[model samples]
Target: MRGWWQDLTDLVLPAECAGCGTPRTVLCPRCRAALAGGVPRRVRPVPEPPGLPAVYAAAAYADEVRAAVLAHKERGLISLAAPLGAALAGAVRAGLRGTAAGPPGTAGAPGGHGGGPAGGGRAPVLLVPVPSARQAVRARGHDPTRRIALAAAAGLRRGGVAARVLAVLRQRRGVSDQSGLGSRQRRENLTGALTTAPHGAALLRAGPVVLVDDLMTTGTSLAEAARAVTSAVYAARVREEMEAYRTGRSRKEGNPVYRASEMRRAYGAGHVICAAVVAASPDSVVENQELTKNVHRCR
Candidate 1:
């Protein structure tokens, strides 16, 4: 248990490493290296849930990694967000590697954030955080995932990736605590539980989007998030077509052919619909090995 002074001190100046309790550092060198050492890898839960976007994780959810995540999330050690966000940024870059970003010298291309030589007219990548439950956010006094996403976006920008955080997903209903829930139960509990804000679809159109979270256990949350995003984008397309038809626009203006092409352009290739996380369950990493091999083979 922690006292008020401890909490205050933790918020201001952490005295011990969040991952290994090494003295006099928010995160000691050993644990920091552990968190960010490995190359980010593709991960998938066994019996992969439908609509789950491709996910990349910086490390397995074990040992020091798990402790660090818990310290930052449950204990509200805000300073840890920087290291965690750096790890997440690595995963995001790995996930986006080789992904289509439109032709060079066009919008959404690499370095598209500014007209400056570094920016090259490329649009910033959008980082959509999985929304936490309202009650949970109130209890924690901060949205951990969103904070991490913001940190990750900052890191990405500093690295010339041109990223921005977009907190556009929301929970549409209440859910029982996911603790102790199996994969199937978690999936059932989260189905249709999330939706995008009215303006979320338009915001997502700014560039390729990457769903981000602090940790992934069963991947139920990310699947739901992906579903909500795709649904909202599809709904927006429908509305555009309906409005065009109502206005008596010609086939060139509102035809299915044109809409399909527009959707492809907006979403790019399958790479546009992917996710990244700081860590994933060890089981997921192991279970996904064969799939990862196949993915690499194709690439």
Candidate 2:
């Protein structure tokens, strides 16, 4: 297979830094620092898309970080997934920490910044990829976002977060290349383009969901993916509530009443807990005096 050949080629070829072409290393120490040295922070795209999840990035997409991502994704430097995954894991942690910064009323939304039950028994966080189009994957010979997401999940589990990659979102239709599109145009192009897979609803309910991506520009893709996920969550909740109503009547003729917060807690508001990315655009860096200022802003 192509992947096997690529792996073999990496073993046989002379090593060089993917970002700067430095000899004798896949990524030089300087480049590694450029890629992940910065703290993860919340980022918002200009003209943010509807349903866009709160997102965090390990580094800004510039200089060596941008080059490294392009090398791994476009130039087939597959070995870089490890470091990129580590970067993404940092972003995931920032977003998970953001849960603790939830505004005043969202206390029971699950996975708070605490270490115990307020965090939903420390349930495993589901990292869902914003899928690449099938055509794009065929042209590129691999799914870049999903590859990095797998690595991120591994890194997260190692760090004791109980994480797993969930490739549940799928493109439901064709889309034009995003290269020439502006933010609003990108949003229009991606509207209703992604949907959850069969039985994905049940899987999504397993734990807190975190949208994962290699890079974010206008955030259209993450927004669409979030819409699809939350829609499924809403439908699943309705079904559960209906079933509960029927069962409650049969058992005690109205012995139990479910609070709205109970429902919101069940699905985390169908809003993704947040999104994690390897890198973000520089303009999105919210420079605040208080480090936690941007943390609760996403809600």
Candidate 3:
């Protein structure tokens, strides 16, 4: 299989910069800087949707960033997961820190927060990777997002945070290609497409859930995923509320669904943070207005 050869060549192949073809380094410091500037800003796709948690993308999905993502996703550049996960780790840290400063959400509960240094009483955190469609995996012969999530979890643990990947998210439906679709179209395409890992509702409901994705264009995927997670959380919350009411207890406000609005507001206000190993400048948000004919577009 070409994939097998590619995988072997990737490891046996000598040093060459993924960014600028510089020898002796697959990813040079300058290029790495492009990724390590992991400031997780709230990114809003033009046609933002509802029920999506505040998502922090790790990088702009353009240029070298785009290439790097594609390299990992399509090419079997499995080695790239480390650096990519490193960027995600930074974004995750930012999200946890911001939430920690505020009131207690599921993230505030014990075992919810992840990957914080042991200097304080910071609890562990959870990393939930957005699931990939079966077709995509079959085509690529790998699960890129899941692989990256695992790497990110490892990186988080190394930093003294008890990081774990909740490999429970699953795609329940097939979506049309997202190349040419507008945000609205994208939204419709992905409705009810995901659910928590089998019986994972309980574990996810146990605390704050951060949904991780490799790229966020219109952010429809993230939004839809948040809805699924929220449904799981809300169902758990409602269950608890009913049980509490039956036992003379009370429930809390705000359901568990992650919303795109939350993430947009966070990015706008610098609250939730997202990072990608490689990304175009943040200015690329404008490209969402029309199908980017220059590169890959669903249309």
Candidate 4:
């Protein structure tokens, strides 16, 4: 009901820009440019979390960007998802340019999943949103990250990328509000707080997975989300191996032990996981300037 009302109002009512409150526009041209005009680049927190995947961000979380994110996430300006998602799509593309080919036999492999001639030379990229706390979602009446992820997937598709949103991650436990929390505190609060859904592993095999978020601050949430996803995928592989062994199909198919070893090696090499967000802290932008020296700017 609330969503419907908001949508109706957005269509009928005059509005101010979510980013800068310019009169009579959802997002004025200048604000839209500020949101997504610059090249997306790799960003890393100062004391980067141990398990955080390589993350790319479209813009720094400051000034207009900050205001827009807050308005969309906290104040329920749901119409803002389109622009935010477009920025996130650019970030995903940037991350993909830097990602190495997947290990052979995995979905990310050249001929596997959505890749190669069978897939029309386009590899599908899965956008797995970092889950929000249930209480927060309930209070806000919507899940901001997931909403943006859906929009991002649409934008990616329109841009000729085979992309789709996968809401596979879920909160397994409650967490304290992260407001005013230090980086260390944020990490501690989110550790072991997330898990993949029961069927998430199978769906994740669709293609290369990129965790998506609206914003990244301390990087704790993304790191934890990565840990949970990796754990689930590993567990699923083990289960498959065990089932194959029990059915005596291991020898007919391939050596289960060798296959498991190869999968473990791929996991250790870290080519399978990466992340992207609409924005990151200004400090990350400063740090990423040097990293972007050789990276081709996304047109």
Worst 10 residues of 4 by lDDT: 290-299
Predicted candidate 1 versus true structure: per-residue lDDT over 1-299, tens digit per residue:
34567657876787899888998889988788777777777888887888888888887777788889998888888889999999999888877763445434322345333223335456567899999999988887779999999999888878767778889999999999999999999999999999988788888767667899998889999999988887777667668777877887746654753566566445541124578999887777443454343223222
Reference-based lDDT, residue 19, model 1: 81
Off by over 4 Å in 3: 1-8, 12-15, 100-116, 119-123, 240-299
lDDT by residue (tens digit), candidate 4, 61-178? 8777888899888888887888999999888877766665553333344444422222454446788999998888888888999999999888877766677888989988889999
Point to the candidate with the largest TM-score: 4
lDDT scores for all predictions? 0.77, 0.75, 0.60, 0.77
Task: State residue 114's C-alpha deviation in candidate 3, in Å.
Answer: 9.0
Model 1: residues with Cα > 4 Å off, grouped in runs: 1-8, 101-120, 257-266, 269-272, 286-299
Q: After aligning candidate 4 to the native by TM-score, how far in Å is the CA of 170 from where it should be?
A: 1.0
Candidate 3 per-residue C-alpha lDDT over 236-276 given as tens digits, one digit per residue, 9 for 90 to 100 = 65576667767865534432133334432321111212222
Give the per-residue lDDT digits (tens) of candidate 2, residues 120-157. Answer: 35456789999988987887888889999999989876
C-alpha-based local distance difference test score of model 4: 0.77
Clashes of each: 3, 0, 32, 0
Model 4 misses residue 8 by how many Å?
1.6
Pairs that clash in candidate 4: none
Model 3 score (lDDT): 0.60
